[model samples]
Each structure stands twice: as structure tokens, then as C-alpha cells.
Target chain A: MRVYHFSEQPYHGAWEADAPSLRVTLPNKHCDPKVAADLINWRLDEWQLCDELGLNIACNEHHSSATCLSASVNMPIAMMAGRTQRARIMASGYAIAQRPDPIRLAEEIAYIDVATRGRLDVGFVKGAPYEISPTNANPVKITERFWDANDLILKALTHQDGPFSWESEWYHFRQVNIWPRPYQQPRPSVFVTGGSPGTAKSSGANGHGFINILSGWNARTLFDMHRLASLEAGHGVTPWSKFVYTALMGVGETREEGHRRLMDIAGYFRTTSKVGEAFMNPPGYMDVAGNVRWLKANQTRGRAGNHFQAAKRDGEKLAIGSGVGTGLGVSAQDMADAAIAFCGTPDDVYEQMTEFISHAGGVGNFVIMAQGGEMPHHEACANLELFSKEVLPRLEEFDQSQIHADTEERVLSQRDEG
Target chain B: MQTATMTVDHVGIDVVRAGSGRPLVFLHSVGGVDRDGAFLQGLADRGSLTAPWHPGFGHSELPGEYRSVGDLALFYLDFLEQEGFEEVVLVGVSFGAWLAAEIAVRDAHRLAKLVMISPVGIKVGDRETRDIEDVFAMSQDELTEAAYAEPERRKRDYSTMSDEDLTALARSRESYAFFGWQPYMHNPTLRRWLHRIKQPVLVIGGTDDGLLRSGYLEGFVESLPNARLSRIANAGHYPEVEQPQAVLDLIDSFLEEE
Candidate 1:
């Protein structure tokens, strides 16, 4: 099984005047940038530690936010390209539409792809309004701009003629040819981030892939849509290979440790301001706006007379109470019973992931949010080590036989039902 | 109160007067009110003050077609001449600073002194300028962090605020865009016209300003023939709020010298 670890540099410490160190308020500790950088370097080192560990690691883009330091995704991608010779570099997605000139994005992506020798997975996105709006560009036009830019970029990358000519309402280009064609034939594997069916359909039709970040009931709905879209597109239906990626936050040496990690991350979300909530939770997608409206509509139905209570009944199930309970050292099964929560030791995480695979038919790829929400650097490193050593082995075994068999069985069942 | 009558695009221009002594006109910033005339009141407390809200701002009725900062300045100049307030002291902040500078450039004889705080007009290549995109992307805390020296104090508890209050805040902030839009902070011609403005000018800068760095203030002061720079430490883009006493002291000393 191919495993990709996602690292989000959670700003977990207080600003130090004397040194570049963050004094974390909770779990009460000092996390220096040096320590954080070491943790990152070690994570990269582990790739060489195992033959099964693919060179592919993921980083993201953000700006002037406390949570992450990689405001420019290119910085990390460039670093990874320079360091690794074999593994693929996947920027989970960059906010390409934010730039006025798409050519800059095309040039950078092509450069990285060429340097990496074809091992590149480019994930495209419109990005959050918090990032897009500040650039004087309308957030409402993000989807349109992304598609237009992508079309131009793809044409520019693959075309060999003296130049390319294209005209769109938003963008017009004459003689657009990007130099140093990618090492990968045609281009790098393109993926789009979305949590809804419409996004899945578009990705499938465009010959691109979909990386889903939804969980619980929504995951089931999204996966089903992706499968149908693949089938309808006449791209032979295979439950395991169809473009689908699932993300989960993992931690723990024991099942208890895993539960605690999940809780710790969840607590981070609860207290943080919803200031950039527009970025994390965009409207219209997953009926987010409708959920907000529903909560407002049913304010009287709440027991505690708070927005949270109203939200529980109307909005997508937020993992607040379960996260708190799990962090407090609650039993895994007990925490699981509280809600459709995902947390536990490496083994527990593997089992839960497998269950999700079964529910969605069969899993093809797993992307773990290995670092998130004020998770300390050392703790993140330890979690990665535990996961690599303990969980990956079991997952690799499942990939060998059970996962394939499960996929076959699921297809057969569907055929029989039809 | 002395009032002036000047017609621009068939609309009446009212210049209200308060206090009495040295003639000084108060130019309201992008979102400020002319009726309340806080700047004029403050100026009037010291001496004579004339306040007028630019067209399309506050209660001012928009003329048939008002365009460009220059048109607004011309209209203000006519009002000043009609009111017989020659060689008057002009005070402006933000976008108002742009209009005041524009007016001074057109006729330096009309303005004896000028004070521009966190002004917007000239573009300096060395400094990283904040565009509309940068402003909108900032969180309330981020915006306040960039705009004020003591951001923690200005950070409001919106949780307890009523929806009406939230709506009002949003509306007020949006209205600020009316004056600051178009070519954004730079007018291209503003820098070239700076040397033409012979009036004694004081440029106030906030050291901690994230939008425009202190280096920008130096460039601004250097552009003007008769200009001096005064900085407020531990202050952001809006030093008037963060270091009000410092701003007051600097203004007082500068005015006394003039």
C-alpha cells in the first residue's frame, strides 16, 4: 500500500523575543523552530529508512497565518526536489488562481517536475477566500479562473509549436509555450481537492483525479459518486484504482495514545477563531451555507440555548465533544460510540481506515494528516515513527491480498445486485 | 459659523465654520462624517476650522458625475477662495491626505501649512505596498494588528455583538472602499507634484505599520521641498489611535513653529 504523510506546521508555541522559539500554551512546552526543522528533516530521513516508504511526501501553501509557515508551497516543493532523487513530490494543492499570471505557476510547476524527473503529482485548487480575496480577485470567480488557468497551463506545457494561442473572457494569450517540458510524458498526474459529487464529476470528465477530504456519511456519498462518474466516463470501473484519497489525523503508541492525539487536535479547532472559517469551510460546497441557515432557522430546538447546540442538529457533525472526551483518555470504542470519530493507536487507526475502505468499497490511496492542530514537532515525529513501523506494515500486508480480494468481492456484489 | 457657496456639477457646496483665529480646514478621511466634524471640532478648539465632506461621502449629495481626486480638490479650492480663507492650514488623513496634497500642488499660495498622517498617494518601489487584495484577506485581528499599535485592545468580542452591529461594521468598512478604490493608493502624478507644494508639510508615520513601512515616510518627506518627518513608536498604520498623545504633541509643536 502506498502511504503519503501530510505535514501541517501548526504554530504551537508562543513568540519568543530572544530566540526563534514558540512557547506552546497547552501541554506546556517550548517548540523551537530548530526543533521543528529537525522534525521535518527526520521525517524526510525516514523515507530512506524503509524501501516500502515511497519518496512522495506532501506539503501545502498558506499566508501569514499562525498555523503554517509554508506560505509559499514552492519553497518546500523545491527543497524536496533538491533533496530526493527517487520519491515523487506532491504539493497537495497550490492556490494557483490567486496569481494574476498563470504562466508563473506553469513555469514553477514545470521546473519542479523537471527537477524531480517525472515523479510529480500536481493538485490544483481555487483555494480559500481568505487567501484569494486579499489579492483583489473575487472569491466567487475562483472556480472559473482556476479552470481557465489550468486549460492554458496544460496547453502551454504539452504543446511543441512555436507558440500557443488562446482566448478566454478572463484570460487571453498569444504564443504561449513553456520551456523545459516536464520529465513525465504528457504531464504530471493532476488532482483536484473537493468534498462533493459535482467536483468529482468534473475531475473525472476532465481526465484528472479527485482527492477527497470528507469523512463519515459524506465520505460514503462522495466515493459512490466518484465510482459512478468513473464508470459513466467508460474508464473501466475498479473500486481500488478509481481516483479517491482519504485524509485522517493519526497518533498513538497504544490505542489510548491514539485517542488522546485525536482529542488534542480537536481541542485546537474549538478554541481557534472562525476568522478564516471561510477558507476551512467554504459556502455552497457540502451545503455549508444551507447548514448555517438551518442552524439559524432551528435556534429554538437547541437544549443549551447556544449556537453549538443548534449547529449539532442542523450542521455537519463537528467532532467537538468526542475530541474532548477522547483526549481525556477515554476508551476507543467508547469514543467511537459517542460519534463517528476516527482515532486510536496505529493498529486502531489502520482498522478504522480499513473500515472506511470497506464502506467506500475499497481504498486506493491513504493521505494522513500526520501533523496538524498544535501537534508538537517531536510528538509528530514519534507518531510518524510509530505509524511507519507499526501501522504501515499491517497496511502493506492488507494491500498484498485482503484489499484486492475485498475489491473483487465488492464489484461482484454490485454486479449481482444489478 | 462661516459658510461658503460654490457650485460643482450643479450641486451646492457648504463649508461650515467653527472656532475663530488662524484659518484651518479639516478634510475628512474616507469614512469620516462631516456633520459631526470631529477633526474640525478639534481644529476649532485650537483656532478657526472649516469642514466639508467630499461629494458622495456622508450626507454630501453626489454631483451629476464626480470623477477623480483632482475634481474634488478643485471643488474644495473654489470653496476656500469663496470663503476668503487664504493661506489656511490644511489637515488630512489617509485618502484626505491625497486630496490635500493635490490641492496644495495646484495652488501652494492657498495653503500655509499641511499635516498628512498615514497618507496615501505616492508609490515607493522599495516598500511592499498593500493592495485591495491584501486588505480584504486580513482577519479582523490581522487587520487590527497591522492597523493599530495595541491590536489586543481594538480586537472586539464580536461573539456578544448583535447581528445589527456586525452588519453595521461590515457596511462601514465597505464604504471605506469608495474613496480608496480605482488606482489604489498611488496616483502617479502625486509624487511629481510634491516638490511644487511649497507649504510647510509634516508627515506623520507609525513605526509598526505593516501596510507601509517607516522607509516609505522618509521617501514621502524627501519628495517634498519643505517637509519634515515625525514618527510615533509602538504604533501601526493608525498611529492616531495607538499613540494619540504623541500625534497631538507633534502637531502642536509643528503648528506653533508655523
Candidate 2:
């Protein structure tokens, strides 16, 4: 599997337990500028290391939050685009709905593609619920804006001349034109995260790649849908490997150490993750049906709300079980067991990941998140080194080609039978 | 309030009607309408009141092609024409005021008088500094604080709220965003078109509206050729909901003009 290294680039400093949300309500006192500077530099160094190691660099973006320090995902990508050669720059952000100007977005992506000489994978999302309001983007019209922006951006990139005037509900541009043409024909490859069937269909219809970060079994279902969509869009026998799978990964000297390290970080995240009802799902963020499904899926009904209640701004951290793991009712070990957390010795991680890839129907791109929450920088680096050296080369032979060939044969036979 | 269902432009919608006499249409704000408020009855007591839920809010059907605030104005204009109401008085609150102005600017021959309560369609200054309060950015408690002039009026026991009430509120905000999210609660070009309105306009606002501020309301009034401003004391965003008798008193003067 082609592995891409990713991190949320979490700020591990003091966080207020009583705050309504890390995104909107949390006071900025928790963010020390000096600490942020160090983290940004460290993250860049790590990404540069990934490039040297012949691994893909996946950069992420989030706004108005200390949960992730990378507010602008493109800055790092643009900076690295000129520097890095072999590694692909995955700008999995510039959130479609939240961005006010899609024309500027198209021009920016094209600039990046030129900088990277075409090694760019554009990642778009409707953005997390918290992101909607901070940008003052309405959740009700997010879908409309997303589709409109994507269509407009594509038009701007594909066509050479545009003083193209188009009117839509969300955007109106009298003269739509962008400079710094993309390195790739038409544009760089487009990838979108799929948490819902709607996104899967959009990805399929647009003939774009689908990435499932932690959907587990649902990833396979989405991949099948993507394949069907690709076919309907007249791109036949589309490689299922284009659908990438990501997991929270860590390697330890022993199994116990592995689980403990992951659990410690999981628990550290619990305080910031105690999202308020309104912040988590704002009014009108989703339609009636979507809201119901979201509420059900994220039922904090049994949450011991006061579990992490601490009098100080730096609240007393709770144990793993009584912490963030409780939000999903899954322990660190449960994550390992489910392949959501690939933590163990190098050999153990390799075995678990092979099983993960096999279970995912053998996706080509296996994205590994080595750093998250409060994991120590040195330990995370060590884990990555071990993973690349000991585990990376071993999985090259594990093949999904047989399954793909068989599926292709089945589809052809079905057509013949018809 | 009595709810009525009808089809306008082949779209189903639920319109709330109250009072009897002249066919005066009362358009609601972002919250749609207040149930336990006396404003509807007060309006009904003076004249026949008809308030159609804007397309996509409450039980109203949202047309697939429905895009801009202009569409809502056309939807109501067609509704008024289809219903055959002649010489109708237009009254609007907050977001509804913007829609009323949009319709009145397009065609004001059938419109007799216009009343805008804390209207929010004119940009008083650069949007960064003088834009309307972003209720979406506020936490629930923060939203409550910024919305009301009275302490008691600001509080609602959400724990005891019914599912229907909660759902309706959510739906209201969604539809509110439908027309208002882009231009961000005001039309940048709306101020230029105010002179086109042929009706005598009454611009009423609460002195303590923490959102748009009273000066912005006056700015809307100043734009119209035949508009006058009136301020209500000890009230907030929904002065009509807070103290209906005072708002009705203000409406009486404008309705009496013709």
C-alpha cells in the first residue's frame, strides 16, 4: 500500500474544561504563540522528512480552534510544493462551503499545482459542523454552495479564457478567470472525504477519488458505490484503490506499551472534545433527516458529563475509559482490535494493517496518522521511523489485483448474460 | 393564530391568519411567529391579518429553483395576486421586512402602506464593523443575551421544550439562512431601491435591539421617501412580541394615513 503520513497537528497545552467548545467558545489564553511557533516548525520538519523518505505528505486544515494548530492547510502545502519533489502534496482542505470566494479558491489550487509541477491531490469537504458558523456559512445551504463552488472552480481551471459571467444563488462572478495554469491537464486529481452516501455519489459522479478516514466497514460500501458511480459516469473498471483508508497508528516496544501510549493521548483529547450540544450540531446545520441520523450517531446520552470536571483551567485529566473513549464507548484496545488503532510492535502493526487493508478490500493508499492528541514529539517520530523501516517494505506484495480482476470478470459476465 | 394551507405558484405553503377587516399581511421575522404573543390578536382586532410562512420556513414548501430573497418577494406577490387582494397593507419584522421591501420596490401599486419593524436590509457601514449581529456565531446563552431587551424575555427553559418546538426553531433558522446567509442579513443594493416604494412607510424599532442598533433602523427609514421612524422603549429584537400593545399603537397611525 502507498502510505501517506498525516497528523491533526493538535496543540497539547492547557485547555479549559468549562469552555463551551475548543472551536468557538474556548478562550485564546490557552494558545501560547511561542508554543504554536515550535509546533508549526516541528510539523514542517516532519512533513519534509516524509518527502525524503519517499512517502506522501497529507496536510489538513481547520479554523478558529486550538484543537488543530494548522488553520491554513495550504500555506504548508504551498511552501512545500516548491521544495518537495517526489512526494505528493495533499491539500485536503480550503473547506468548500466555508470558503467565501470559489474563484479565488480555483486560482489558489491552480497556483499550487504549478508549484508542485502537478503532484497535487485536492481534498474538499463540507467541513466539520463547528467550521460552518465561524465562517458565517449557513449549514442549510452548504450542499448547494459546495456543488456550485466545485462546478465553478472546475470551469475556471478547464477553460483557458473566462470573463465568464455566471449567476447562482450563492455566488455571482461577472468575469471568472484564473492565472498560473495548473501543471496537470484539466487539473490535479480531486479527492473528497465520504462520511455519507451523498458524498460517495458526488465523488462517483464527478469521477473523483474517495477517502474514508475511519469509517471501517462503511468504507467498503462507499468504495463499491464509488465504483458504480464511476461506471455510470462512463469511467469503467475504476481502480478501487483510489479509495484510501486512514487509521490512527502507533508502534510500541510492547503491546501493553502500545495500548497505554494511545490511551493516554486518547484521554488527553477528552477535555477538548467535550463539545457543547449547540456547537457540535448547530441549528439548521443539516436537514430533518440528516439531523436525526447525526443525533442518533452521536448520542452522548450516557455521557458522564462531569467526568472531566476540574476547577482549574487545566482540568484534571480523566482516565481513558472515563474520557474521550466513552464518547464512542470504545477503548484504546477496542480501537486496536477493530483496526482503527494500529498499535503494537512493528511486526504486530504490520499484521494488523495487512488485515486492515485486506478487510478494506485492499485500498492502494493507506494513510497512517502517527501523531495526535498529546503524544510526545520524539516518541511519535520514533514510531514513524520504525514503521517505515520495519513495516513498510513487508506489505508491498499483499495484492488486491486478484479481487479486482475477479470483479471485472463478474461485471463482464453479467453484461454478457444480459 | 389560525393556520391556513394553500398553493401559490404550484407550491404548498402554510400561512398563519388572524384578525378581520382589511386584508393586512403580517410577515414574521427569523423566529417566524410567536405563539403566546398578543400581536396577532391585536392585528386581527384592528383588521384581517394574513401571514404566509415564507417558502421553506415552517410547513411551507421550498421550490427547487428558489434561490434569492427576490424569489420570496415574487412568491408573495403571486400569492397576493392569486388571492385577489386589492389594496393590502404590508407589515414585516426583521427578515420579513427585507422581503416586504423587495416586493414593494418591484411593484407597489397594490400595496397601500408599509411597516418595517427593526428592518435589517441596509448596510449602515462596511460589513465588517456595522453588519447585523451574527446570531449563528452566538452560543445559545449568548444568542439569548443579544436577542432581548428584557431579562425575563431572554430566558427559555430549553429542557422542558417540546420536540416540535425545537424542530420548528431549527427549521426557522435553516430557512432564515436560505435567503439571508449570502448577503448576510442585508441586501447591499437595497438602499438604492427604497425610493421606488410608493406606499407610506412606518419604520418601528426597539430602542434596545442589541442586533442592528436603532441608528441602522433609522437609516432604513431615511432611505424611503415617505417613511418615518418610531422607537419603542424597554424592548429588544421582537418589540412586537415583548410589548404588542405599543407596536399596535404605532401600526395604527400608519394604517390611519389613508
Tens digits of per-residue lDDT for model 1, B72-160: 78888777777678768888876778789988888878778999988877776634554322454344455667787788886655446
User: A11-85 in candidate 2: lDDT tens per residue?
Assistant: 767454455556666677888899988887777777777787767888888766766877777888887786688
The DockQ figures for the candidates are: 0.04, 0.29
All models: lDDT?
A: 0.61, 0.73
Q: Which stretches of candidate 1 lie over 4 Å from their true place?
A: A15-55, A133-137, A196-198, A227-246, A251-253, A261-316, A319-342, A373-382, A396-418, B1-258
DockQ of 1: 0.04
- TM-score of model 2 relative to the true fold? 0.84
| Top candidate, metric lDDT | 2
Summing lDDT over every window of 10 consecutive residues in candidate 1 chain B, give the lowest-scoring window: B166-175
Q: Model 1, A274-388: lDDT tens per residue?
A: 2332233222221323333433433211111111210111343343322112233334343343323456777677777677666666666666666566566567666677777
Candidate achieving the largest DockQ: 2
Q: Which residue pairs overlap in candidate 2's backbone?
A: B19-B44, B20-B48, B21-B48
Which pairs, if any, clash in model 1?
Answer: A13-A22, A14-A23, A55-A87, A134-B133, A134-B134, A135-B133, A136-B133
Give candidate 2's fnat, 2 decimals: 0.27
